[model samples]
Target: MAARGGGGMTASTRLAYQYVVLRCVPRVDREEFLNVGVVVYCQSADYLEVAWEVDRDRLAALDPGLDLDQVCEALTFVEGVCAGDERGGAAGAKPPGQRFGFLKAPRSTVLQPGPVHGGVTTDPARQLDHLLSKLVT
Candidate 1:
């Protein structure tokens, strides 16, 4: 994606992006998890995106009795967080960077955020979609 800048240089403005993998832990005691979703935030471009993969087979392999509906609901909630929807709680009221920080913060729960990673992109939206396809799906 070619982004035009003031100086007529192609792709001169590279946006900064941060992202985290959302994981599901069927059993907290066992310390096991599965990558179920991703949240990507690009502040310079004012872009925030999320993507998720639903693999019942893999989930069941981890825990045959897993309540898939609950797990999916949690994943959806994570998306809501990224979108600043009503489901995001007070975190929704914050700015994009703060919201990203809230989502990327480490927590011990069924739906936990993985490590935070950074990247530079000429087009944040395209990079977001690319990451969703490569990481989530």
Candidate 2:
């Protein structure tokens, strides 16, 4: 049988996903920030994950007094939320969609999420890594 969508690929192979870039705004007042990580969620694939890397030098350039440890801690909390483990606490207990919503919600904190963007991917994990490299790194 011919595959659907004339692409010779089953729907299962092309899963829709959404992602957001996580930024660290050392000083909310100045609104200066650096891309530190990315969060990817695919409901069809039941996948949710986050990857992050901190450029200590770049972050320090934004705010000399900014605490690097605090930034790492916040990023860890986000990773925990994506994992839906105990580290996320109450937010982690919710389903993937809810967790994504909570994470994408706007906040004034140092670590904030950018606008949500969507795309199709065959492998959510691979897509997450690609986004992490393209957008965060």
Candidate 3:
């Protein structure tokens, strides 16, 4: 028999999630970028979050003139959106799925998101950390 839990639901079942790698594009014209973070959205779990780390040495190598502060500020805004906080502006007020959609949309900016990818996991938070380590670090 299948295991059950609260509300008669499966106690430990895999959940579908979507994610994108956040990139620091120092030069939009040249399209050179470094993977800097990961954003994961799991509707089944009502989860949306981002994990990022700015590799100062790598970023400086990519573009010595790049503005690290501005990139970090942009990433903060993204975090706010994921948290549905005021700092994210209008996007943050949106629903979790909508916020994820906003984050995944393509844009020409210092911080850009890579293509969306999907996976299955029982825990999105752990998955985010895993992707951040594997893809960004």
Span of 10 residues, lowest total lDDT, candidate 3: 1-10
Question: For candidate 2, lDDT tens digit of each residue in 1-137?
Answer: 10112123354698889999999999999989999999888887777888899999999999999999999988888877888888889999999899999999999999999999999988777788899899988
lDDT values, one for every candidate: 0.75, 0.86, 0.87
lDDT of 1 by residue, 1-137 (tens): 11212223247687677888888888889988888877778776676666777788888898899898888887777666667778777887778788888888888777788898898887765666677677766
Best by lDDT: 3
State, as a TM-score between 0 and 1, how close model 3 is to the true structure. Answer: 0.91
- In the predicted model 1, the residue pairs found to clash are none
The local lDDT score (0 to 100) that residue 92 gets in candidate 3 is 97
Model 2: runs farther than 4 Å from truth? Answer: 1-12
Write model 3 residue lDDT over 1-137, tens digit each, in one string: 11111222254878899999999999998889999989999888888888899998999998999999999899999988988889899999999999999999999999999999999987777788899899999
On lDDT, the stronger of 2 and 3 is 3
Task: Provide TM-scores for the models.
Answer: 0.82, 0.90, 0.91
Task: Show the lowest summed lDDT stretch of 10 residues, model 2.
Answer: 1-10
Q: Please give the ranking of all candidate structures by lDDT, highest first, separated by commas.
A: 3, 2, 1
Residue clash pairs of candidate 3:
none
Clash tally for model 1: 0
Count clashing residue pairs per candidate: 0, 0, 0
